[model samples]
Target chain A: MSESDIAAAFEDGPAFVPYLTAGDPTFESSIEYVEALERGGADVIELGLPFSEPIAEGPTIQQAIVRSLADGMTPVRFFEFVETLAVDVPLVCMTYYNLIYQYGEEEGPRPFVERAAAAGVDGLIVPDLPVEEAQPLRTACDALGVDLIFIVAPTTTDDRLDPLLEHSSGYVYVQARLGVTGARSDVSDHTSHSLDRLKGYDLPAAVGFGISTGEQAGEIVAGGADGIIVGSALVDIVADGYENDLSVEETADRLEAKANELTTGITEQGQPRSERL
Target chain B: MSETFGRYGGQYVPEALMPALEELTDAYQRYVLNNEDGFMDEFRQRLETFGGRPTPLQRAEQLSERYGTEVYLKREDLVHGGAHKLNNALGQVLLAKYMGKERIIAETGAGQHGTATAMAAAHLDMPCEIYMGRTDTNRQRPNVFRMRLNNAEVTPVDIGRGTLKEAISEALRDWAHTVETTHYVIGSVVGPHPFPQLVDAFQAVISAEIRDQLRERTGALPDSVVACAGGGSNAMGTFHHFVDEEPVDLYAIEAGGSSLEVDQARGVAPNSASLTTGTEGVLHGARTRVLQDGHGQIMESHSVSAGLDYAGVGPELAHLVETGRVTPDSVGDDTALAGFHRLSQTEGIIPALETSHAIGWLEEATPEQLGERVVLTVSGRGDKDLETVLEETAERDIPAAPQMNVFSNPTTGGDGNE
Candidate 1:
C-alpha cells in the first residue's frame, strides 16, 4: 500500500475512520475488533500503538493504553499485530514520537518506518511531533512510500498551517476542539471554522477530537469534513467489554454495529437530500 | 533565538499548544530578553520585596572541617517560600500578568514548586491551581496545605504512579484547553524551547548571587559547584553564570533510589538517575536523556526524595552533560538520608531531601573530586520533609540521626499531659 491508498479511501464519500488500541484487553481480541470495524464499512483504521506516556489522550484512551501495555505490547508486537490483521483498509499507526524515533538500532525514524512499511502499515500520526520537528520523520515516510499525517488544531496559525500542509500526506487530522482527545456530547462550533480554514488546501481533512456519536459525525461531515475520526468513544465500548467481561464475539459485534452507525451517518450527509431523492 | 540545545530541545507537544508556545516565545524575547515595558525591572523589584532576593551565600565551617575543603552554601533555603522555586514562579506569574493571562497553573512533585507558585500567584493577585501527583501529595502533605492556604486549588493526579511526569502531562492537557486564559508555569528547567531557557533565566539569579558574593569574600570563583538534578532547575541555576568559566567544575547529583540497573522486563528503573544512565529520547515536550527501555518505552523511576523521582532530565542539562561542561553523579537513598541527618545536626540547617542528594555526594567524593573551594546550593528547607524524614529515618540505621526510636512509638513521648 502507498499514500495514494489512504487518499483514495475518501474519494467515494465521507470516510469513516475508527480507532482502537492494538492490544487492549488482549491481542487476539483486538485483531477481531479491527476486522469487525472493516466489515462495518470503515475506510481507514487507526491502530493506536500504545506508548507508556500518551499525553494527548484523555482518560478513556489512557486506560486503554495501560491495558495494552500490561498485555506486553511493544513496537515489534505492534507491527506483528498490524501484519496479523486480515482487513483490506489502509492502517495508520498512531502513537507518540519516542516509540518511532527509538525503534531499531542506529537511531532515527528510518529503521522504524522501514519495518512499518514491511508490516503493512501505510501511514503514521504522531500527536507530539509538531511540524518543526517533523522533517526527519516526514522524509523517512516519503522515502518508504508511507504518508506522514499532521494534526491541525483550531489554534494552529497560518504560518504553522502552511508548513503542516506542505509536509502532510494522506489526510490532515482536523482537531474539532481546543483540547486533548476525548469524547464530548455535542459537536464543537469551531469545527466549521477549522474546515473553512482548510478549504484552500487540497488535502483531505478528517475531523477528530470530541467526536463520538453518529449525530456529531453527521454534523461534522455536513460542516465540510472529508472524513470523521472517532477514538475515545470506541475505546469506551471496549473498556465496557473488558470491565464487564463480555465475550470477544459480543464486543466485536457491538463495535461493528457502532462503526456501521457512524458510516451511515457519514454517507447520509455525503450529498444534499434533494439530489439523493 | 534558537529553539534547540545541540540536538535536544524543540517543541514536541501536540499542535494545539503550538500557538501558545509561539506566543510565549515572543513574550520571553520581549519581556525577558529585551526588557520590554521594563518587565525585567518589575520582575527584579518583585523578587526583592516579595520573594526575598539576594539570598545569602554563607560559608559552612563545620562542613569545611569535615570535608577538609572550604564549603560554601548558596542559601536558597532562605528564600521566602523556602526554596529556589519562587524565583521562576514569581517571574512566570508576573509575565502572565504582562501577557494579560487571567489564571495561573503549575505542576509539582515535592510541592516546593506548587507552594512557591501559589504564593507568587497570591502575591500578584492571580487565580491559581496546581496539579500534584497523589504519591507526592501524600508524602508532602504540609506543602499541599500551604498551597491551599495561599488560595490555590490542589488537584491530585491519580494516574501513572502519580509523580511529576504524570502531573506535567495533566497540566499540559489543562493548558491545551485553557491556553487563551491561562499560563502554565512549568516548575523545572525542562519542556520545549522557550521553557527551558525561560525558566533558566529566572533561576540564574542563584549563580549571579554566588558569583558576586563568592568573589567578594574569597576574591575568586569557587573551584566547584554542586546541586541536585531532578528536572535540573537548581543545578542549571547554579551553573548558568559559571558555564563559560573554564576552571569551575559543575556536578549534577541525581537520586539513585536503590540501584541503577533498569528492570527492562517490568519497565521500572529503581533509580531516578536520568542524567547518569538515561538514553536519548523525547519526553514531555523535548528530546532529552530519559529512562526508557530498548523498545522506546519510558520506565517508572523511583527515588526516596519525591522531587528527584522523574524519569527525564532537562534537555539543556542533557546537552551540557553530553558536551562535558557538567558531570553527573548519583547518590543512593541511604547516603542521602545520612546527608539529611548530618546537615540538620552539624550545620543547624535542615536541608530539603532534594538538596540532601547533593550533600550526600559530598561524602562520597574525594578531596580532588571536590576541589579546594566547593559551593553547593541548599535548594530548599526541610520543614516540609519532617514527616518523611521521621518515617524513613526509623527504617534506616543512619548514624547521624538522633534516637528516631522515640518517635517510632509515639505513646512514649511526653505529650500525654497535653
Candidate 2:
C-alpha cells in the first residue's frame, strides 16, 4: 500500500474504491475477497474491521458487522490477519473509533495507529472522529505513516469545506447524502456539487454513503468525483452467496464477479494528474 | 472547545449529522440572542399552562424532623406527565414547531422522557415516535401506555441487551435516515454538542426557580443542592443557578445498585456509579465518563431506578466532577428504596424511583450537625411505581402510621370505600 498507488488511481478515471467488512463469514474468506477485489479492479480497498456498535450504519452493513463481530473480529484479530494479507490496492481501514482506541488495551501495547501502520494499512476513515476532536489520533497516524482521511458532508457549509479538506490526507471522503451509510437507488443530486466544491483541493475526492450499484458509482465518477465507494452492494453479494448452498470458493467467485462488474461501471481511461490540477 | 465544558464534551457524531446539529445550534443561539420569534415565550407559556410551572416548593415538615434539618422539595413531581421530563420535552417540541419540523423522534430509558415527548408532540400536533428498549418498555408499563395514549408511536429496540444505550443507538439510526424531516428531541443533557448545552438551558428553569424560592423563604441560598443523575439533565438543571454560589454545595447522586467496588470475590461488577468508577470514553456522539470493562467495552449497569441505569453520565457532570464543582455520590439500591418508603410515609409524597436516590444520599450521609436548609428536586412522581413498592414492601411486617389510619373505618380497620 503506497500513497503513489492511490494518487495514480485518481490520475485515471474515478478510482473505484470498494469496501469489505473483514471476517464477514470468516477471516480466510475476507482475505480471499480482498485479493479478488484487487483483481476485479478495485483502486483502494476500504477494510472495515467489525465493531459491536456502529452508530452510522444502515441495515445492510449493520448485519454484516454483526456477523463479523459474532465471528470475533477484534482489532488485534483484524490487524493480525492484515499483517499477512497481500493485495495490490492500497488498503484503508474504515470503522468506528472505539475499536481503534480499545486496541492493545492490556498493558503497554503499541497504540492502534502505530499497530495499524505496522500491519500495512495505508489510511484511516473514522466516521465518528470529527476533526475538532481528532488531535491525538491524528498525531499518532502522522508519526506512523498512516494517512488520516476526513469526511465531507452534503450539509457542510462553505466556511467549513476548506477547513475540513485542508488537513485531509490520502483523500477526502465525500458523504453523498445527509444520512448514514447505505446503498441508494441513485446518487444524491447534491453530490456533483459537493465534488465540484472539492475540485480545487489537491486531494482525491471520493464519494461514498448510500452507493449500492455500478451505475450510481459510474454517475458520481462521471460527474467528476475522483473515486466511488461501493460498499453494501459488494458485501451483500458475499452475504447472499454464503447464505444457501454456495461453497466458499463459489461465494468468492460470485463476489469477484460482482466486484468486477461494479468496477467496470466506475473506472475510466487514464489521464494525466496535471490536467485536473 | 467552544461548545465543550472544560475538557469533556465535544460533538463526535457522524458526518451526515453535522448540518442538522449546526442548524440546531444556530436556532438555539437565535432564541437566546434575539428572542424575536417569541420562541422562549411560547416555551415558557407552555411550561406554565400545560406542565404547571412554579410547582410548589413544599417544606417537608415531617422529613425535617426525621433528618434534623429544614428540607424543601421542589415539587417537579406535580408537573404534567408526572416528571421534570415534561419541562425539557415541551421546550424542545416548541423549538421543533418553531423550526417547522413536522415530526419528532426521541429515545427513552425509563419511559418518562418517552411519555413526556409524546405529550408534548400531542399538544403541538406533531407526529412523534419514541424509541425505548424492549426491557424498559416491559419494566415501565404505565409510561408505555401513556405514550400510546398521547398518539406517539413507540418502537421497542431489542439490540445490545435492550436498554438505554441500545435505544439511543436505534434513535440515532432513525435520525440519520430521517434527519431531513425529523427533529430528534434528545431526552437529556448528553449526546453531541449543542444538545448538551441546549437541553441544559431548557432544563435550567428548575434551578432558576429553586434559587428564587429558596432565597425568598430562607433569606439565603440553601447550604446544599442535591439531585439524582441519570443522563444528568435534572441534576444539572437543579445545580445550574447554585453553581456560582460558593456556599451552596452541589451533590449529584448516581445509582449504586449494589456497591461501587467491583467484587472479584463474588464476581459482581460495580453498580451504575458512572462518575464514581467510570473512565473517560466516547459514547452516543459525546465524550464522557463511561462504565466500561477493562477492555473499554461498555458494561451493563444495575440500578433499582431505571433512569440511572446508564453507561455514561452527561459530559457537563463529567466536567463538573473533574473540576470538583460537583461531588457525585453513588447510593445503593436498598438505601434508595428505604428513602422511597420513608419519604412516602413521612411527607405523603411518593417520589419517582430516580428522585429517591437524592433522598437516600441525604439519609446515608447527612451532617452530624444538621445544616440550615436543603433543596432537592423531587424529579418525578411515584404513582407509576405503586405496584413495585407494594410488592417490594410485602415481605416486611410494617404497620401503617396510627395518624394515617384516622381516615379508615375504626371498626373494620379497612378501606374507606367499604
Worst 10 residues of 2 chain A by lDDT: A267-276
Which clashing pairs does model 1 show? none
Model 1: per-residue Cα lDDT over A1-277, one tens digit each: 3338999897777889999999997999999999999998899999999998888989899999999999989999999999999999999999999999998886799999999999999999999999989989988998999988999988898788889999999999999888888999977788898888888887888999988888888888887889999999889999999999999999999999999999998888875322322
Q: Which stretches of candidate 2 lie over 4 Å from their true place?
A: A1-5, A101-110, A241-247, A268-277, B259-270, B368-370, B387-418
Report the lDDT tens digits of candidate 1 across residue range B196-298.
9999999999999999999999899899999999999999999999999989999999999899998999999999999999999999999999999998899
- Per residue, candidate 2 scores C-alpha lDDT tens digits across A122-187 of 889988887777777787876787888888988777887876876678888988887777777876
Q: Write the per-residue lDDT of candidate 2 for residues B1-418, one digit (tens) a residue.
A: 2788886788888867777888888888888446858888888888999999988888999878878888899999999989999988998888888887879999999999999999999999999999999998888899999999999999998776688888888899888768878899999999999899888888899999988887788778888788999899999999998888877888899999877876533223458788988887778888889876544556777787888888788999999999999988888877787788778878889898899899888887657423678888999999887555554444333344122234453432334212
Model 1 interface CAPRI class:
high
DockQ of all models, two decimals each: 0.86, 0.47
| lDDT assessment of candidate 2 | 0.81
For candidate 2, give the DockQ: 0.47
Docking class of 2: acceptable
